[model samples]
Target: MSRLALAIPLLLLALSAHAEIVIGLVANRGVEETRLDWQPIADDLGQLLNQPARVVAVKNEAELLASFQRGEIDVLRGSSKVALSAVEGGKGEIFARLALTGRQTQYRSLLLVRRDGPASLDTLLAHRQQYRYASGNPDSTAGYLIPQYHAFVRNNVLPERFFRSVTVGNAEDNFRALVERRVDVAVSNTDDLPKLAEKYPRDYQQLRVLWQSPPFSYDPLVIRRELPAATRSRIASFFLDYGRNGPDATRAKEKLYWADQLDGFLPATNRQLREVTDLQLYDALFRLALMPELDTSQRQSREKLLYRRYDQLTALLGGAR
Candidate 1:
């Protein structure tokens, strides 16, 4: 072969060998914080699979979906809502679910208000136009979706119509709003409550849970469905067996648990996410009812349809309360 021909093939081989396996982490924290938490897992996967692995911090669920569509992310870890959305969009499949230490595979969203505040679910409902509310991003499962469904479809109290104002932000922003008495109510999850309490004991001490949503499954670790079979198998094996065996098991367990607050990972299949999928549907209907462009009659129709769908999904999941 000619020297140019030989060089061309060799360069291609080197490029292929160095191709990075990008794992997308849903950003619940700052990019630096998320990268620090997930880098160990990426590094471990690189060693196990003998492939270059890196973690990409996705700013939000929308960005995560967009990245998946662009084929920028090979693996994903985030809320079950995000996972189900990716699967429904034909972009990804569930490969594993995190098992938190001393925590179930499920968690619940809590509606909170200051213990001494004049805000309670009842007071807010009574004084409809007087109370402000804060919630997480629209894509958040525990933060926005579940809480919206619980309030509107389940209780027939539309926040947009009832509350004085509604603001959407991340957990920290929402909690801070509530703590500073800027918002009358906020939504947070059980998993995050402990951390908040630990971080801000005084603010947390003044907070009280006004309501709790039905349990939701822990987020799933997903991989793009278009990835090679060998790559999928290798990634799955790493998650499934991580911290469970080998001489370095203890160190691996500590690293994963301390960094990500997960005990380990368990094998998961798409079928196991039916409830989450249903929740996503419920979230969509709830959001539709909140559209300001919708006429009163149109909004009512959407609310009625949402209530019916909620009942149907709850029946399938053995009730939401």
Candidate 2:
């Protein structure tokens, strides 16, 4: 009996070890939104690997970067913007870029307000003193970071000085705040709109889009660099072979909204990642140049920082030789 007991405990431990994997989700929006939308993908991963997958939704860019650096997560799924930054920092690599139906770029942001509330972006800009503004995460592409950088920073509006409030949260929370009359302006994504509208008809009915940004690039499924190459290959193959299991696989495909997502996972190199990374760096530099907060002295300091980064980037891209 004692021998049997020892064997049983060992077996249980083996099973437990095999069943656990920690994943980091980009918490660009709210934790609830990330969990709710990506649960199916997580579940699918678990079933494929015969393991239980745990997802940690990280807030803000710094948190995501830190978690990735510490190897706390096995995979990261985020927009091209976030993925690019992570890649630049050497924390991960793109295993696959997502697509849906005929769409390649899921990056989009719409400036919105309550349907009965706002007339236009121009009118809102003119009376910017009258309303509150909610942003998604400061690092979020379609959410806060990009839109704000484009609007107030590029246009020299200075959000805090002009708007009543500039709050940050998930896209859902931003929209909800608008619906609840807590904020007068919020930014959201086009990819998420149909899904959100279907989920909350009343809220959708009350909102109106003031403007939409041009499409940029799609999100990427990033793989941790520490994982063994064979293991990485196996996981990539598993994800790419989604429909081979008949009905369950088909159902899984629809649930995760990968009907038209890439044909399969592809081997990605650091160079591929550099494409998006460079874009974000330039975008940040542009914002810094246009920032309203910087004085002449501050501008010179900012210019120094920008030029230093530009030089480093050029060297990294093999341009400084």
Candidate 3:
């Protein structure tokens, strides 16, 4: 056999392997539309790279973060909280950040009560003795942390003193708790309530937005660092170009919020780690102090856990080896 013939076949095999890269997409809660309406984005992405794109629905932020650490996912459409964590861990790269609009492109923490109940934050505060409080998750920014921060951390309304009881769960669960009278006041985000209402009109009709918080930052999409630079850039370009409109133009129009549905992702400048830094600082100053620790080891473990994320982000972004 000729050496040239053998080399040609070997090169063809290598090219075949290169062409079949499977892009893993991790889905968290917010992109509910993406899971239901996958065709346009997936097809567009597939057409762009000429490779198969698979969307994997992840249940929560923890699962999404875990998958990124194990190198199981190639791209993530996630919350600011989770994306920033991925950025800090060095497991992913930030190609573009999502910009959500409404009262300054920021989301507010809302405190909701039953439709027939007291109508104000102070009213809820005074009646804390008579009602239970439910928050999305302890670690959730809009659902639990921010609301509690304002109510307890800033306003001197302690969790124990404000509510007769407290529960932590998913966003849906928080709303459910309020509707079913499981809790009197449920803390959640204003941006999320619309979708929740759209899904369950009856239940939603019974609740009202009692209080809203100041605008916080929007979420960003995190791409796994191991992906080829070309692929990363292409994905970013695809989103920048068609994320707001084109394929599922009508639905995409509804989803992207700017005046003309032109609200698309914008690239991060300065590679800022501000969100993660602020969160850690807040977690330490507030959340940590609120916890009842069983041992000093747990505290150290907590620090290491957060640092591990930072190390991963640093390594992936080329800041760390």
Candidate 4:
């Protein structure tokens, strides 16, 4: 090979070395907040991996999945639903999950109101139309999915018709809406409650938890399945070992526990998203339950078919790795 040919190979190798590895961060709260919270971790991962790492903050779960579909993201740390979608799409796999003080495998959705607004869940549901409601995006698990079924559907009160008005936004927006009394009722979850407290201490203090949902799994760390095995191993090890050892180990551990209220990460699999799948099923059930036009026989037929599909999926997921 001539000198030019050899140089060309070397140049290509150098260019590839600097190619950015995009880590998709779902901005459920908003892009700026997501970037602010996750950028440092992305920087550390880049330096450790000897590759250019960039955080591609996407607006919501839909955009995150779209980006992954377009091959614009190499790694992702977001909701379990998105993680499961990636795996189902055959492009990704879960390697780790957040490990907090307790309930590492689960988190809960919450219904909140001003301390004096509703003394109890019964009061709120009894006088449902007297108040405005702030709900999380339709895509939100805690804000919309869980509570929509548990609090609204189960009670036979549709928020859309029951509330005087409804506003859709992120957890923070809904929290602020409640604190400002912009909305009489708001939905939130364990994942965002602590951060909300940090931002609005006195305001947070004025609120009361009206209802809480059953626990579900935390989000997972997912990477493109096509990534080199060595690269995948390094990324998983990085999360699992974070703050566990290093000269700055103590400080790192403290920040992990204090700032994020997370001890570290635990190894996780894509199958852990079973409950989220179940939630989606719950959403389907919500739609079916609300179809008042359907005759009793038709509704019963649909319910049976739906439950059959649900059983098959539960069995399928239970059999997955």
Candidate 5:
């Protein structure tokens, strides 16, 4: 064969070898912040797979879903809500769970009030209607979903119906609202509290935990189902083995911190996300029950549906601990 013919095949091989893989990062912060946080992980994955990998920060679940639908993202790291949504939408499959540094694989949602404001949880719950509240985005697990389910559906006290007002934002925004006295209570997660304290000790000191939800599992790392089986295996193995063993184990742990405060990734399956799926189902049913447009009959039907699902999920989740 001529040299030119050989070069043509070599060029094709090089092109195939460097195919770009886009990993969608859940935007807990601004796009730039998310990019900076996850870049190390992206680089590490690229090195491990010998492929060009990049990170894409999605502002919310909607944006993440859109990206998946457009086939723009090949990997995802996000809350269980986002991961389950992707799987249900036929976009991805849960392959591993992200464990936070010092937190392991479980965390909880917290309700916070100024230390001087509410002396006790009873005091806060007693006059709940008189105070404003700040919660995380609607899609947030610890910040919104878990708290809402615990405070509203489980307790039969809906903030929307009883609180003075309810504002939705990110963890930092909600915590800032609490510290600034913009809202009387703020919903955040166990992991975020320490970070907030570390960054704003004075403000964090002003806040006290009023209540906390039961421990919830860490978010899962999802891979696009469309990828080749071998490629998927490589991706799964990379995360599962990261920070666990090898000469670069220490460096891998450090890199995880740079990639969104993670300690490491643990091997996980879709079955491991069962509880989160149950939570999501319960949240949706509760929301349906609150639909103002529903008539008496419709509302009753929704209530019945909600109760049925609540029982089913509760049972599946091992009777809610």
Candidate 6:
């Protein structure tokens, strides 16, 4: 009886260790594209963990958050802002950061305007209401937050109130709208610079960068904290070693598979998220300051909450490097 009891507990523990993993992805290039691009990686990860793994591709910030809230997602690989929220809301932690093959580990936000419509940033800003805008997901560091803070709010312009209209989508869609002349300005990023050149060469030529925000680290892989620490360490080791040295004879070249995304990953911690977090906090404070409709009492109360969260972020992550 005692032996059977011990074996039952062991069986339960082993089965729990192999719990199915749901990896969350943001379909930045559309759901099909995102899945096609990531399925190989997910398959490989499941192989390594010896566990069944699946992916859930989300199209926007809200969907991503909802998946995390429902406990349906066990992992994430996306924007730093999204990672920040994941680390907070999902009780997850950063495990690895994707290394861009030949590029800097950090990328900057880009504000693009049609070459013929608005000649320059100043022209767009000066005649803001005359032009429509296309932006990235609000939770995306490059798309909505950085440009809003750098070009709009700091200059006393609020996008929704200043532009003739503002539309939101992934970078590719927003760029498409820009090329089709549906929107006058689109916020893109350095990471997509090469992609723009290749996929939309003609349209790429017709577009010009209006502004660039400060640098931000690349997307990170965040996993829920309930995973075993040993498993997390093994996963980190897998990424850190995956793309280095050269292609393996047994597998296809990472360059061929991931394009610019997989140069291998650098093991990371939550500290790497601080820079974007700083922007997120300051952006809130600045936007609050610029809100025309915020009465003194509401402003004060919101400001108090924002600052409290700001302080908590600072305390938890330390100040940005």
lDDT of 1 by residue, 1-321 (tens): 699999999998777666789988766556777788788888998988788898888557778777876889988887766776787677888888888877468888888888875555666567768778887777777777777787555666767777889998766777889999999888888877776787789989889988888887777888998877877898899888888888878888887875667788888877666766565666666568558899989888877876786566455434554
Expressed as tens digits, the lDDT of each residue in 52-160 for candidate 2 is: 8777776665576577778877787665556656766777777765555443444577888887776877788888678899887766666755676565555667677
Local lDDT at 316 for model 5: 44
Worst 10 residues of 3 by lDDT: 20-29
lDDT of each: 0.77, 0.68, 0.64, 0.78, 0.79, 0.77
lDDT of 6 by residue, 211-317 (tens): 88877788888877877788777667666666563345226346324634556677788888887777777778877887779899999999899888877776676
Per TM-score, what order, best first?
6, 4, 5, 1, 2, 3
lDDT string for model 3 (174-265, tens) is 88889998988888676667767877899998998888877776556678787767777888777776545466655554545422123566
The candidate maximizing lDDT is: 5
Specify the highest-TM-score model's number: 6
Candidate 1 residues lying further than 4 Å off, grouped into runs, are 1-14, 118-120, 282-321
Model 3 misplaced regions, further than 4 Å: 1-34, 100-104, 127-129, 157-162, 243-263, 269-273, 287-321
Positional deviation of residue 177's Cα in model 1 after best superposition, in angstroms: 2.0
- Each candidate: how many clashes? 0, 0, 7, 0, 0, 0
Candidate 5 wrong stretches, greater than 4 Å: 1-17, 284-321
Please give the TM-score that candidate 5 achieves against the real structure.
Answer: 0.84
lDDT of 4 by residue, 1-321 (tens): 699999999998777666777888666566776766666666777888898787777656778887887778888877777776787777888888887766365789899899888887788888856999998767666677789888887777778989999998878888888988799889988877887887789999999888899887777888888777877888888778877777866766765664356778888876787777777777777788779899999999998998886676556456532
Off by more than 4 A, model 4: 1-17, 28-30, 101-105, 254-259, 292-321
Worst 10 residues of 1 by lDDT: 312-321
